[model samples]
Target: MRLKPVPVEIEKGKINVDIDLEEGKTPFIVVYCQGEAKITFLPEHGETKVVTHQGKVKRVKFDEGEDF
Candidate 1:
């Protein structure tokens, strides 16, 4: 299944996204970043009646690091 990309705004040095998922389905997110950037997912989870999604953006660093 091809999921359309959703644009998220950076708020207070962070980003938040909410999407619907069907029950018993495993859903993943595709994060696209421009230029030199890093993304880290923190150990966190939120659950409701049916869906369970985890994590948050920890930090994004764009600096001189080891060549990739």
Candidate 2:
């Protein structure tokens, strides 16, 4: 069985993402949105690592709304 990836818009800054899913092939929810999103997501434990999206793809961890 398979499920469609839900489309979501993450604002620039700290946003809490608490959702559960089965362990297997999963689609990314950020691809729908354009630009460099500095998401501090640690899939290991689902811990909250807040970071901002910077202009550069390398610095995508800064809170500045712009496509890297």
Best by TM-score: 1
Write down the TM-score of every candidate: 0.31, 0.19
Once fitted onto the true fold, the runs of candidate 2 whose alpha carbons sit more than 4 angstroms away are 1-34, 37-44, 48-50, 53-68
Alpha-carbon local distance difference test for all models:
0.37, 0.33
Tens-digit per-residue lDDT, 1-68, candidate 2: 12224434456443344445565424233322343322232333233323335632222222324344
TM-score of 2: 0.19
TM-score of 1: 0.31
Candidate maximizing lDDT: 1
